[model samples]
Target: MANTVSAKKMTRKIAKRTAVNRSRRSRMRTFIRKVEEAIASGNPNEAVAALRAAEPEIMRAAQKGIVHKNTASRKVSRLAQRVKALVA
Candidate 1:
């Protein structure tokens, strides 16, 4: 129940922002899932390619505050290590 005009406007803005953030987060997850699927398939080259595609998106999500920086870094680190282990 937004009582004031300003509060109603703020609610509308929040709804719009929420939709945008949700889409961004979903896109990021899709990228991460692609990497995971590639890894699970045991194709190192495919995994590498997926990781290459996903890294920037993950970082972008972090930059946009969708995820924490360390969370992003840790995910990238772990995924990279898995890809490396697959390669080696």
Candidate 2:
């Protein structure tokens, strides 16, 4: 449906970007899930490690525009809190 050459190129670029964003989002979710699973398993050490690993991935996703900044911050904060509680 894109008659103009520019439009066709734009469509291609959008498709590429969408795939990259989807991959990034999926990877981020996987890291978050790892942290949640560790937490649920009640292993303070493993939860701490997973949270440490997930924090940077979440922040990177936010930096890359795949996720909102506040959402990333909130997730990191809550995960850290939960990890701390596990240690207590």
Candidate 3:
């Protein structure tokens, strides 16, 4: 469909970027899932540790444009709250 050489080149670049973004997104979700699993297990210490590990990953995802900045912050905030509640 891309008739121009430049357009074809852009398509290829976009595909490559898409794969990279998908990988980063998957990695970020895995981190979030780990935190959720820790929370579900009801171990306050483990949950806190998982959150600590995930917060940076989430922020990094935001930095990389995989997720919105506010969304990342809100997610971290909610996870922290849950961890605190579990601790209490």
Candidate 4:
């Protein structure tokens, strides 16, 4: 459908970027899921550790524009609160 050479090149670039973004999104989700699983299991220590690992990944995704900063902050904040409550 892309007749122009430039259009073809752009299509190729889009495909590559889409693959990368998809992987990044999937990776971010996996980290978040780990934290949720830990929390659900009701193990404070494991949840803390998972949150530690997930926070950076969530922030990174936000930085990359995969997710909004507020969303990432909210997620981190809520998870941290739960982890803290577990400790108390």
Best model number under lDDT: 1
Worst 10 residues of 3 by lDDT: 43-52
Overall lDDT per candidate, in order of appearance: 0.97, 0.96, 0.95, 0.92
lDDT of 3 by residue, 17-36 (tens): 99999999999999999999
lDDT of 1 by residue, 1-88 (tens): 9999999999999999999999999999999999999999999999999999999999999999999999999999999999999989
User: Could you tell me the TM-score of candidate 4?
Assistant: 0.93
- Taking every candidate in turn, the Cα RMSD to the unseen true structure, in Å, is 0.5, 0.7, 0.6, 0.9
lDDT of 2 by residue, 20-76 (tens): 999999999999999999989999999999998999999999999998999999989
lDDT of 4 at 15: 99
Best by TM-score: 1
**Model 4 residue pairs with clashes:** none
Candidate 4 wrong stretches, greater than 4 Å: none
| Top-down TM-score ranking | 1, 3, 2, 4
Between prediction 2 and prediction 4, the one with superior TM-score is 2
Sort the candidates on lDDT, descending order.
1, 2, 3, 4
